[model samples]
Target: MDSAKAEGFAESLVDLINKGALAVMISIGHQTGLFDRMAELKKFTSQSLADYSGLNERYVREWLKAMAAGKIIEWSSEPAEFYFPSEHAAFLTRKHGSDNMALYTQYIQVLASVEQSILSCFYQGGGVPYSAYERFHEVMAEDSRQTILAPLLDQILPLIPDLTQKLATGIEVMDIGCGRGKSMIKLAENFPNSRFMGIDLCAEPLESAREEVRRKNLTNIQFKQADLTAFRPAGKFELITAFDAVHDQARPDLVLRTVYESLNDEGHFLMQDIDGSEHLEKNLEHPFSPLLYTISTMHCMSVSLAQGGLGLGTLWGVEMANRMLREAGFTQIRENRLPHDPMNCYFIVRK
Candidate 1:
């Protein structure tokens, strides 16, 4: 090996190792509400921050130092002050709500928890079940709360012009794989005239959705624990939505066809999933490619393979998605990318 090239590789390895450790620290900060507490205080010493957050001071100090080293927060030597700048606070704290990165960082620990199962699949050629992922529904719901529900009215729904108005005037809508029913609930609450039904294979999330509906007193929305591939509605719907949900299904192609059959003549379907390239070489250039593929291997692909499914995984690119939509009898398909969300591809399809 070239000496210089070898040195560069070593440096890159160090950087990645540091980043991995820092990611766990970031997750810890997010979970413990340390980031939020620091944002509220603006600037504080380790002891003060620990007292404010109800955490141990020594651990807090080490975490603060890590944050400073990671360039996530500002550190001062003279007065030993740690500061969360407003700019950093915006992305790091829950104050920015759905726009925060801390919410996504929580996935690091969750995915890592199943490393053993993922390894077993590598050797045994079998896959982990959905239940293998503990807290998956909860984390997924929190993720939806941040990425989808929190911005639904202002950002996501408005992507289709006049679509909101159609819902406002009363229309039948269905959401497939509607984990915890965050998007549907939001839509139902915002448009009481519209009727919404959410379906999922998992009972846990559906139960949570029903409980939330009762709490919200929403008459326009309902949740059912039904397999998407086998589900048939009494009547056709005017609109359908799937948010980061399609790739995980055991029979995603069948699910697409079912959605096509279940919609009225002019009905539209909106799907949001990982933005990826069908070509692996092209995907290698993507910023989130490593994480995406890792997620697929560890969770998305594994769960589907466990069921003897197609295992499309999280990185099913628009190229493949478009072909599938066309195959499912969707004549009009548009691929869109939002400025606010870089992680997903938005597919607007019409029958």
Candidate 2:
């Protein structure tokens, strides 16, 4: 190997290792509300920050040192003070809404929890189930709330012409793989005239969805636990939605076909999926390729395989998704993108 190239690669590896450690620290900072508390202060000592946040001072001090070393927070040697810059806090705090990168950083720890199981799957043939991962649904619900629910009314719904007006005028709508039913509940609350139903295979999140619906006193929305692979609706829907749900299914093709058949003749299907390509070469310049693939291997693909389903993986890509849609009897399809979300692509399809 060339000496120069070897040295450059060695440096890159060191940077990667440090960034990985920083990710875990960032997750802790976000979860413990340290970032939020620090954002409220201009400059303070570790003990003062811990007192303000009501956390253990020793642990807080250690985390602060890690953040300072990583250059995530400003450090001053004169009086041993630290400052969490507003500019950095903008993307780290929950108050920042969908722009919060700290929320996404939690996935690094979540995925790391399954490292042993994933390693076993490497040597063995089977995969880890969804139930194995803790707080996964919770994380996914927060992710959906920010990415989908936050933009549903102003950005997402308008993708299909006259869709909002149709919902306002009363239409039967269904959301497949509706985890926690946040989207359906939001829609039901906004458009009281329309009837909404959310279906998923997991009962835990469905129960949580029902609780939220009851808490909101929403009569227009309902939740059901059903396997999408063999789902058959008693009544067809005027609108169907699948937000980042289809690709990881045991049988995405079957699920898509069912969605096609379960819709009215004039119904519209709004699907949001990962924005990628079928070819590996095409993803060379992808911003989140490494993270996306790691998540797929650890969670998405493994869960599907555990169910004895097709491990389609997360980056099934636009070409593969379009071909599958067409095969499922969708002839008219249009792809759309939003300014806020760069990770997914939206599809407007009509039967």
State the local distance difference test value for candidate 1: 0.89
Stretch of 10 with least lDDT, candidate 2: 125-134
Off by over 4 Å in 2: none
Best by lDDT: 2
lDDT, candidate 1, residue 123?
86
Using TM-score as the measure, the top candidate is 2
TM-score of each candidate structure, all chains considered together: 0.96, 0.98
lDDT of 2 by residue, 21-137 (tens): 999999899889999999898699989998999999999999999999999999999988999899999999988888988888889877887889999999996788877787888
lDDT of 2 at 3: 100
TM-score of 1: 0.96
C-alpha lDDT (0 to 100) for residue 342 of candidate 2: 93
